[model samples]
Target chain A: MGELALRKPSGTLVALVAHTLRLQLKSALIWGGVLGAYAAAMVASYLSFGDPQQMEQIMAAYPPELLEAFGITDMSTIEGYLAGQVFNLAPLALAFFPILALSAAIAGSEERGTIDVLLGNPVPRWQLVVGSFVATAVSLLLIVFIMGAMMYGTAVLADTELGFVASVEGVLNLWPISLFFGGLALLCSAVFHRRALAIAVPGLVLLAMYLADTLGRVSEDLEVYRDFSVFYYYAPEGSAITDGIDWASFFGITGLAILFALFAVLVFRRRDIYT
Target chain B: MCAVIYTEDLTKTYGKARGIRDVNLTVEEGEVFGFLGPNGAGKTTAIRVLMNFLRPTSGRAEVFGRDTVKHSVEIRSAVGNLPGEFALEDKMTGERLLKFFARLRGVKDLGYARELAGRLGADLTRPMRRLSRGNKQKIGLIQAMFHRPPLLILDEPTGGLDPLVQEEFLRIIGEVRGEGRTVFFSSHVLSEVERVCDRVGIIREGELVDVEPTDNLVNKSFRHVRLVFEKPVDPGPFRALNGVENLCAEGPELRFTLYDDLDRMVKLAAQHRLVNMEYERPSLEEIFLTYYGASEEEDRDG
Candidate 1:
């Protein structure tokens, strides 16, 4: 018989997190590479435009509501341009990385008939929920880091006026909001056994929140409704690039992610795990 | 021997769906216990309850003297389980999967895993998606046995294995028993249970009908008896004998199901100048059908 290690509570959690992270590394890199390349391309496009002032003039003619709707705070600078072109819209697509990953953690594992074999070991149910969330949270940061590198690297090569710190703030701010959606997916994943519902619930929420917050910015009548949308708290008016990351919203969105994950832990702990 | 597993009135139900009900069972240490039932007979449900995968609707269960629900992790630490239906990660090779599980289990060595893989002919190098059903089953079995856990809870363990692999698996079960470890496996395959199980629990329609020594369950059940007289004899005397049932007479041959009173039947046959005699013990499958035949019909009808 092989020698067995004494089962420690912390050790099990670490092992689970490490295992889940390892499985998620490839997907994270692929997501990061794709989105990073897009961000880098946006930086290149900004540089290719002959003069920043002329580009700002053209953007100014587009109307303030249209600019606000697109989350363009200032188009005269690369920070503003990349914020509008990449980071603002990036969460809409990039958030799905963690959303898809976290949703698969529980409900997806059940659908695939893989949960039984995994939970058959000494893993606690809460560990499955928390470990997946922690790993995915880390994976989300990796994606953000990769996007940051690509965006900043392109800015440096093109001699754009974008600051390294501003670029860092722009990409770093994407983490919490993306993770907030991932948290919802994890909650859904825990509450339901079907993976489709887990993904769809969060997907629909992401679309609705984006539209509510975007339209709220364009119309006074819809302004109150923006408070209900998570996007309301995610980089309002592209402030993360100009004013640096809003510490309040950063932690708030992160807090919400932890809240949803906590709820997931509670719900998953009480329910019977199928398959 | 102390009880390794004990459950009292353990029941689990899925809304209107039937699950196990009032299942009280005790499995002693170092014994191979077989849970026998056909499909949808709550065998999997019962096993799930024991594993704490499904909570009981009423009553409770225990393993290693600890509550199944509260001490599940500790119980699982000492147990090796193979679920009735499971899928390994498609991207993971069998070796990688085992290593991951070993890490989770805090086991540092893969030597036993490798040995079991070799013995079972499990190809650990290939990804799970590339393996056939039988090959997947071999991996499943290896994972359950590799850690050398004290209690092995295997559900429908040999479902997809070929005969040769099944034989090797039974041999492994024998070795597990030799090591004084307990095995609790559920299967609808009667011959497999008969070959390895010391005690067999028969469940029907979401309830345990009987639990007895395998030998007793097989031996005490009815057998088929045939007698050939010198010439055509009246079947009345044979039918009148105690415990004789379903008597049939054709020419000089007499055949019937004998449930009891073998001595009296033999004496009666001797009086008729029995030219030949054949007595055969029924298989466990036949015995299961015979014992539960009425309830099975009632289930089908209602």
Candidate 2:
């Protein structure tokens, strides 16, 4: 075979990953830019909260249970206030980017009738699953880095006190959580042929977990269920911005992401590609 | 001769819908094999199984002596496939897409790819979304044939092309054959298959009905025969001929299908003052209908 004579023993996986990453770069920049702008706006608005005590007093007027439900512990500092405002809620929206992208990796391609052409190459099925997950994971990190740079740059331009290290940690903390949902979406994409189902399943799970972690804080009866939520493990409240990275929650979430990705590879390898 | 494509009792079932059943076939090396079938006749299903896109429900398939499922990557390494219904990335230009595919296949040189684009008149600079269906199909054909693989599996390869472009594609297939590479393609168009394929396999209702050489298939089928006399001739003698079917007789005009015994029919017509005769080959569809219709009749008679 003349074609076989040119074959390399490896690098197909790397090429697949690189190709997927290149395809995702434009979307990554778009998602990162939008989220980063939101973060920059939040940092700029923090300048209006002139006195920490005054801002604390205003936040204290709200119901304590509602504040706790929203993870609003202390607005007395920029990190504390922004943590509850940005990092706490940003992952809920940002995770969907990966969810939408990863859901389309396999099932969405099949729906578009593009999977046949992609899989027509000699790349292994597992490589498709793993390569897509790896590319999306890297793209998620790019989004986080962009958002972090925006947050820190805005702080420096506004002459605010948001430390570069803390901002980096805060944005990087979103990676594990967002990637967790991305992994779930990958698994769903592998298991289901319908792209809508792949997206909707993980999307619903994200919403339910958010509600479980949020409502569980307000209701005594629901508190027991908080541990079941992925958000429970993702306690970025004072951990990311104030103290440091919570290695336990960080590795725990990352581990779950890896698990879901492995499951996706296993499931996808055996299934028929409809497209 | 070693078989380039082999399947033994290969079957695939999608829920209640029949995909393919007991398909045992072998396409030897260096021959152009045409898979002929109507829509929903399991042509795509069988091709998908061979590509390992769909798993076989039972039995097995092998390409170049490697099991399709066990060594799909190795098999695919030697094969180039063009799907029946395929879409490229809308944001990507054809040049970029081919380069990416080349990278995946570890193909360093794009000289052949560029040559294919030139020959097929594919616009590699434009994004896939901007191209018309025929343009996209040109790109699709280029991508499949560019690598010069050992075997090419194309499904309805000429779906959206003008006649001139279709002629160009046939020439390319002929060249591939001349190079001793195998081409196994599926199509509903019989004329193209007749022109390019060495052998044609007819599939009907999820089963392989027949596989025969192109000449044998065309020669064995019936032909449309018309006879005109100077005056109204008796239709009785012609009607009594053994192989004549669907006989129709009017004043000075007689038309019927002749299956065999052409000489006997010619001698019978010689007795009358034969004014003119019109003998034409039946179309592939007509032959297909006759084949299936006779089989169904056989079932009823049994």
Candidate 3:
């Protein structure tokens, strides 16, 4: 009918995501608080052991099990630990903040019955999908930038100088990491219309990936499974925290984010527009 | 006739459950046609199919000669819809919703929208969550009619308005008719349809029973006459009267409904000292049950 009514680029969908992200900016505060506490602890440990060898010794004694569980190993070393400790906490921060924001974004509209009115309008179905995806993507990037700044700001207060390069690398990890989950969250929101699943679906998937990564690290038997986990692609171990930035992994994860977002769009097109 | 809306053996089924079955209807240009039916009787489903909200299982339906799915956007652009299951964005005020609808339809000026809001008592400033259901219905109506589309596919368009507001809505429909545009409305209220619609299609259990003019229906369907007497009434004299279908006599009055002409009947009532007299039209529900019968099985068996 008249070439599908000249679909708009979905400004409304973008608007929905932007509003959701703005509501969760305090995530930066949460990320900052965690980084600040870790920085404080690192400073005390550094003061106790003035020797570089002693610093390495104390770093080895750090709870390897807990550290491994969180995908935080290389970050424990003096040079590497500075960035690792800050970026390591990102997955947790993302699992909480942006999810709370998404809970209000997708499911919230349908819960209030506003989805019916939107469906009645001339707005195309895919626009709703992509608009929401773009909105959350933009928001997740903002959270990353804000938290990155906070981590850099916290690293400055450390007695041991972790240079700007290390700090930049630490904060940069948040982009790819957050993008993976952000796309996943949008996908979940598209699938489910409940606050619990809207947050839990993506959050659990990310957590499960981190857990799978840990299990793989403890034994070679599960190593192959790591490739399937988005967590593995999120922050490639040999990248920033290992002293070299992995552009391949970084861009690969970014590409994965686009793929996840595209999947969300495709799924939304076939499914019934919720009443 | 060039039907503004029509269907050819149209059917829509949701999995094993049927939504509308073989619903074939045609509304002439400029006539106020009422697609009357009870709740869950496939009225809304049929409307949804016509709007391309749902795909038909079999048969075909077209609006302005365009397939609903292929041309919903084009057909919808020319058609205004007020969904039977009314819902609107709560964060937006009545004014904002109107503006949004107007803008969605490409209304460049707020003046026209403002005029409709004023006439309909729609407060555009307050968010939709604060407005009453009647107010919400008003907003929906304003959006539907503001564009002044030549065709309207309204599903229970006046669900929540008070009687006065309902009358106001009817008056607007009358005006729409005067402008020579087709107003295709569905409602559970039979009298409303009887009062406004030039022709009506009574639907029941996903099937259309009959389609005819309101006046012809009123004249041929049933005739009800109320006669209040000066003294206690007797059932015997009234029941024996010619053309009497049903006659019930109370102690002091007779309330009876009869078929055929009333000239001889009125003379019979005058013979017995009548205190007051009244005549009534058959309700839409009466015609509804009469035409569609009761159940799907009953209609099929008939």
Candidate 4:
């Protein structure tokens, strides 16, 4: 009993965050490998176009509105083509990984009856919320880095001239949008006891936002609705890949993620954990 | 003795369903308090509120003189808990889980955890999903005890355990009591509670019906009485006796329930040629039913 004297609750937050991050490493690699392979293959496929100008002429036959909807403004450069093909829609799908993982952090753990044992320790409820978000945020970054490396490594292997900085900007830009939804899922998990609601709320928002952004680009009437969607802030087009990282959108999306994470902590701190 | 756990009119309601209702309880230090209840009797609910896993709807609870909600982290630091419906990550082995929990509690040594595992015959190397319910229960016990916290709040700690393991666990609990530590655990099994607990609190239908010392609770209940006569005898005297209910009579055998009329019964039996007599105490479940079942009928009548 003397050996069990209480210690200061200092390192629990760090320990929990690190443990969650370590647990997620395997899934992070798998997600990174799967998504990265697709990006890498897209990079390698650029060489098969034979002539960029001729291919651009062939793509020009498609409807202008349709091409704009898909973000195919230019197919001549590998950066422009990969931006439209990979970066444009990849975040929409990739965001679900964080949503799924983070939702399970609270609501899912409760559903599985594991929350009691975990919370049986002296962990602060706020730490559980914040630590999960931080870990998943870090894992999301790892996935983004892996995707960027694969794209760059494939470009080097194929002798393509995709700027390393552009590739880095393109993948790094996905972090904020993915983490934004992960934060939303975290909030939902804290507010609601059902894991399905936690996953579905953010999942539906992701799809609606994607449609709002894409449809807004094609129609003036729906364009106003795009401002309400989170996708409006995620501009991973020529701006992220060709121009540079959009600092405003980056901060806006990340700031919203932090806001949602704060709400998650507040709600989780007050709510009863049903097991 | 100081009260290690105290609740004042604690209540928790879930919509229309009753969780716990104005429940008051006190668990003294260095005593093993058994929270005895059947399923859906609010034992788990009360324990969860104490752990701060669920907040009380009304009133308050305290652990070691600190508010359960306001000082949950501190309370948890001083307490080891095993939830009734316990679970562990399916992919993690018991050893890894213990190590992870140890880190969270800032415990550097795994020596006690390893000793508990060995004593319980728990295979720490196997993943949780691969273990049987009893094995998982063993791991749960080890984790709750490894920290050696001053207070242990275990919900159904002996659930799914074999007789041998349960015996070992009871032995450990006895040792904990010897060290002047407080233990509060919930269980539906009475024999184990009778074996290890100093006091017993019986809850029925979301209310604390009775709280008494273990010996007193058993002593106050009815007993099964049997009398064998020398030859065929009339059953009129036994059947007409007060406090004798559920009487059965054969040619040379008579059986009945005796409630607080042992002296009268012995005198009545002396009138007959008593060849053999047998009197057995009722089980805890029967004692519980005698209390709640009668009260339920009284409520219905009102």
Candidate 5:
């Protein structure tokens, strides 16, 4: 057989991303379908709450601070209802998909003894890190879109006041925050050899930042600490569905995710991979 | 002939743990170089260093005349590597995995890959999780050979293979050598190395102890000498001979291991009326044992 010309690093990166995304397709769908169905169910359940005044009374029984902690402003509207029911909690769960996927990018593959075979094909180390991040990012978007479509479909079916644009904005806002955590997982994956540490560090940070953000909403003293959390810039007061998407915070959070991914590439490139 | 692999004082230390140290070696182009060692003897470590999986702590190596560290991707582009320990994705079938790798290498054809799969009996349709260890080894072998790279660096290539498969693998290695491709094969199994390797480098305790042509390594080593005399002869005279050990005598039969001074032993044996005489070259495994045993005894004496 005649020799095949060597592939450029860019070609390998593209192939890596394509293969990773293919591997993640089933997972993305499962995550998206489960979360999307739950969001849709929430949209369906909103219609059974009776009249607006009765819903107001039901929401009024709960403490305002408790409501604010969960990002629930007006439970009567579909936007406010989903803001608390799905969008707020979805990221806490959705973030894990990428966290697991991206963590598996370097450290997890190393532990599994799979990296050597893949890297044996003339792939640059940076391409591995970058390809994983990009693939997970795309998968995250698919999950968010699925969730958004389900929520929107249910809203239309239930004849609720939720606009298509509002549903898109709300779901779109979940992307960066979820990806930010996923990026942190990638960085951890790059720096550490064990996949458990890669998953745990980002996982612990996810819960802690969430707690800080939630408690900060309920307590004035802790509110200052929320500024340091990625969740702080996410959806403040369940506003994305009520209002439009927060473009500044959206880009800022996505930029932070990209930054974490970049740091992952740097660390992964220098370290020795152990299986 | 040009050198395909060159290393000068290559060292890799793992924070007080034992790794390869200052190992100087060379593998010429198209030569079948066997890296022989027991487990944890730095065979894998040295191969890993050459593959650029582990950065050298000191000194350097070059593959295909390119510095291993600086041009790792380029080196890898022309090298087919089978790591000693590896895992395939549980969810992917062998066919899918190869296609994915084929895409990565920019190889347009899967014809060679399919042929290899057929030859190795690699069940390309089954997910890797379901394959047996030996079966997985077959897939690993196929993936490394399918690309037809210039250099094949295989670590414990026949680790879990059955005898028939090992024979087939040796045949494949021979064919690779015939095609002017270099194979840097590592294994603790002496017989396989003896059969295929043109030159063998024996590593022990994280250092290369010897590197020489396979024929030279075997022929230049000790021999097993047996002598049967017409009448019962005094074993005392033969026992005191230089470079002779384990001299056992029963009636007229005398058997001993001869490391050197074969001429003196022959002369001493001629003093008795010899009925039969036999001198046999040791197998590679015996030669390897003798080599290791001598070194170990020296170490103990110190």
Candidate 6:
């Protein structure tokens, strides 16, 4: 666990990304900047909702399905629109970064033959995997937490009456969803040992899940496909956009993560380190 | 003597390609075993398998009495490995990379890594990506030796270094061997192996053809001798010379494999016009080629 701590999930994640990002402090600033901009944009959209005439006009422009697809089902009021902006559009940015982050831990290491150098030590492969996963998970959790905090602040500033707890809940709802995507990406990295494949994996996963969700909502015959996408469990359909904390769903996603991570480790161990 | 590194008909395949096949090898404890082969002879593959980077297709490999595949963690804990090719991260400073590997190997300080790197003339400040091939090899060597593992597996470890650095690498090996650790290192270059290795294994394609002490293998093999005379004469009389293998005759020149004592041959040659006489050492490269047998995949079935 000492070496495991060194390869801790957050550290592993940071290690992966720092190198690819040239280990410059700029990438961190850049991610922070993006979240800040998203927060600002959500606040601007909510401000437009302060005008009843403009709010009604904006709501009529996009259909409920389109808004829901974007996780923006309500622009009827300021707080609702902020919820739409954070849970829907924001998770995409957070979900995929961690995959890139985690895959960098192994895919990049294996690619460069650095895995040989690192594994030449006494540390077990399981520790390396766990450390990498933990690093990725932590980085992702941090990114989502910052985004959630910013969005919650934006929701309150737009409508001063909005409850901080409700706003925070809406923001936090996206963590497990991001984890599920991160797990999916980890599974892909285990299967395909190349960085290109690892980089493209998260996108393909999200696309497949989106298609599954579309199929789930469209026709009666295709409803079974909804079970395939973890997004189905995270769909924002509550009154406060993310009413109470869904511990069961969050834990369910965590369970999925453990399963995916275990599968990835087992698969990784059985095969050769692909050059 | 106990075998520090041993293999019993070890086999490894990638898809349909032969990685290593039916390779029976043994490295005595504290002996420096040089794995000799041409490029793609599975030198790297075999080492990778022994290091647990790859699983064997069949058969077994053991390091210090531990199964390479099953007890990989234990094997790794006790082995230092240097791969043939590795791209260092451009972002990490050389100091950082060395420290990371040293720490991973359970070293509290980078003292040993820095010592080896300094002896090898590596620049710790520069990013590894910026280093020259020779310098990168220095880093690879440093990382593997930092832990002082009982068994060191190096694959093509000294390709880009100059003679001076090559000498330094040899010195490191000597120091390691003096401590009673076994070194299993590979090189396509024969002279290097001839100079340092106590025991050497010749691998061609994916097969292990021969394994013997350096002096014994060299003494047992034939040298191609070429002699010149003032006039043409039948050289067939010398064909039955003791220890000779391949024999050939040409006008005014006699060429044959010389396995017999060179002193007798020099006396025999002193009788001739002796326009010119020279013997060329049979290269280990040529000896390695004997095992390639065309393509790697084709020889597996045979």
What TM-score, computed on C-alpha atoms, does each candidate reach?
A: 0.90, 0.93, 0.82, 0.93, 0.91, 0.83
lDDT of 5 by residue, B1-302 (tens): 88888999999999999899889999998899999877888999998999899999999998888889988998898899999999999999999999998888778899988887777777999999999999999999988988899999999999998898899889999999999999998987767887999999988878888899988775667878999999989898888888889999998899998888888998988887889999987765576667764565688998
- In model 5, what is the error at residue B150, expressed in angstroms? 0.7
The better-scoring model by TM-score among 1 and 3 is: 1
Comparing 3 with 6 on lDDT, the higher-scoring candidate is 6
- Cα displacement (Å) at residue A5, model 5: 8.9
Poorest 10 consecutive residues by lDDT, candidate 6 chain A = A1-10
Tens-place lDDT per residue, model 6, B201-230, is: 878868897888988766765678988888
Looking at candidate 3, what is the lDDT of residue B160? 86
Ranking by DockQ: 2, 4, 5, 1, 6, 3
Tens-place lDDT digits, model 1, residues B1-302: 88888999999999998999999999999999999877888889988998899999998998888889998888898899999999998988999999988988878899999988888889999999999999999999888888999999999999899898899899999999999999999987777888999999999888999999998776678989989889999999889988889999999999999999999888888887778999987765677678864565687898
* CA displacement after TM-score superposition, residue A167 of candidate 1 (Å): 1.0
lDDT per residue for candidate 6 within A1-275, as digits (tens), equals: 11111221123333433333444234534665687568767676667556757876877887766665555555665556666665555666767676676676677678877777767666567666766676566565566556656666665566545566766666567677777777767777787888778768777888788777655665567778878887777762442344656777778988888788888788777778855
Ranking by TM-score: 4, 2, 5, 1, 6, 3
Candidates 3 and 6 compared by TM-score, better number: 6
- Against the native complex, each candidate's DockQ, computed on alpha carbons, is 0.38, 0.51, 0.24, 0.50, 0.43, 0.31
Looking at model 2, the pairs that clash are: none
Model 5 sits at a Cα RMSD from the real structure of: 3.9
User: If the candidates were sorted by their lDDT against the true structure, best first, what order would they fall in?
Assistant: 4, 2, 1, 5, 6, 3
Expressed as tens digits, the lDDT of each residue in B1-302 for candidate 3 is 46888899999887888688998888888899988877788898888888776777889998877777776666776777887766676666766666556556666677766776777777778877888888888888877777777788898987888887788789888988998888999987877887899998878878887788977766666767888989876767678877786677777778877776577778777777888888887766676666555766764887
Local distance difference test, each candidate: 0.89, 0.90, 0.69, 0.90, 0.88, 0.73
Model 6 pairs in collision? A9-A134, A9-A135, A10-A134, A10-A135
Clashes of 5: 0
Q: What share of the true interface contacts does candidate 5 keep?
A: 0.59
Which is the leading candidate under DockQ? 2
Candidate 1: tens digits of C-alpha lDDT, residues A18-135: 9899899999999999999999998888878878789978886898899898888787888878878887799899889988999999999988888998888999999999999999
Report how closely model 5 matches the true complex, as a DockQ value: 0.43
